[model samples]
Target: MRNHKYLFLFTIFFFLLGFMNIHFSLFGIVCMTLPIILVLKDRKKTWCQNYCPRASLYTTCGKSKKWSSHKTPRFFIKGNMKWIMLAYFGISLTIILMSTLGVARGVKLPMEYLRFLIVIPLPFDMPQLFDIMNIAPWLTHLSYRFYSMMMTTTFLGLILAMVYKPRTWCTICPIATVSDVILKK
Candidate 1:
């Protein structure tokens, strides 16, 4: 079994990936992030190292054992991971902002449906339940909104991984795939 810390971070990220908007209600985010907060006093790579699927996939891709030591020219660290993260996040955020604004202005772009699909909840039926309950509409709206952000971010991250390192996000991802694999081996 993995440590609680791993579960803690993964739960939050999974929750965000699945349900980010719920704006007016902190219930979901709170319920999800609580464990991470509790474990913050003794933070570790418990989450990223053992339980994350993304990390597992990357590890399966067969990286060089010394890949982390391969330094980029302008970096202080021996690894090129930092630059990859920076580029991915920067481009992702920029694209999200521009795409969102364009959508609001009725402009068309490729993968525009993804913008809607990402922000919207998965299973496609739960948000409507909130509407039936007459709960906060912002919660439903925000859930959809944040997902758009995450999709853009994750997509950009994936693209940057191709250009930079093989698994840049997995390197610092707060999930537990790595730790579990090492222990099991």
Candidate 2:
């Protein structure tokens, strides 16, 4: 891990690898899943504080903005927004799984492109990088969906960091919400 000297590389690989072989996007699933597992076992935000590569990227990028010293907005810090984000995360994950299952069972659900908020498809296109392999189409679909979800969250985090403060997006991060609810941290 380069003794953690280059943490953003962890985050960048998911985005870049998918361009070469979309199946590499499946790594997003492990990143998505690990925080929950760590929180459940340790009852801590160790993942958010230390292991999250996107947080690393956001912090480095946000600090570069210089004008990002503004207070985090009330909507991101107060009330139900964090819970709402968690709900959106949950729903999007469910849709990804169910859609994959449908395709595995021979249903012809449309493959996801780069989605913005999980439901809204964005205009960017990806090569069908998995077509050369004989794997089931659902694997490729799942890979793309996971990549889109990761990108969507990373984009939101970067925007929040730019407009307010470095790591400000952590206030409403879905996994942070989960940790707070579970560990009261």
Candidate 3:
């Protein structure tokens, strides 16, 4: 029942805020990110062990203890950690790049779709694109609020990730949450 509840939450529209940069306002992003930290801090594997698709992938790829046929690796905690970390980082960077490029190019998804991207604390200076691309949106300038919000949330998220685990962001990340639902079941 809990799994179904999580799966359902992942599939819903509002929770999609985790995927985008401008969805639920800045405060909303923190609300979503906090739960992920709590979940990963659970040393008992309550979250990833039962819920993460990437976790399943790691196990199947012989990168996780759950799939090592009961024989654990010597560096169980540290072994191959970088690879997993890199893979997760790469995916995140790709998604952000693609979404930013898409939005900057005037690629219009539904407002709801944009909500997901908006909720994430996007790290890049999106407004700078106007000057860099030589585009003309001479009306509204990037507000101090935008950068402040972005930096604050992104910095907190990173600090949490570094202090806890490398891919701490992915734990409750809407993108990862969605992908896990799509691929795991």
TM-scores for every predicted model: 0.40, 0.89, 0.25
Q: Which candidate gets the maximum lDDT versus the true structure? A: 2
Encode model 3's per-residue lDDT on 1-185: one tens digit a residue. 02222332432332234233332234433433544564555423344445543323222333222321433233423355435544554554465555545555666332222211235433443322122244322111122222233334344444434344433444444434534444454
What are the runs in model 3 whose C-alpha is more than 4 Å off? 1-22, 25-76, 108-185
Global lDDT scores for all candidate models: 0.42, 0.81, 0.37
**Which ranking of candidates, highest TM-score first?**
2, 1, 3
1-185 per-residue lDDT for model 1 (tens digits): 23233343543465454543333233444432443543453355443434544444333332434444233234423455455555644564455556546555556332312253234433443232232355343334444455555444455445435444645554533222233233455
Candidate 1 residue-pair clash tally: 22
* Residue 185 of model 1, lDDT score: 54
lDDT of 1 at 149: 52
Between the candidate structures 1 and 2, which one is better when assessed by lDDT? 2
lDDT of 2 by residue, 25-116 (tens): 88777886798899888877778767788888877888788573777778888878898889999999999899999888887664857788
Cα RMSDs, all models: 10.4, 2.7, 14.5
The TM-score measured for candidate 1 stands at: 0.40
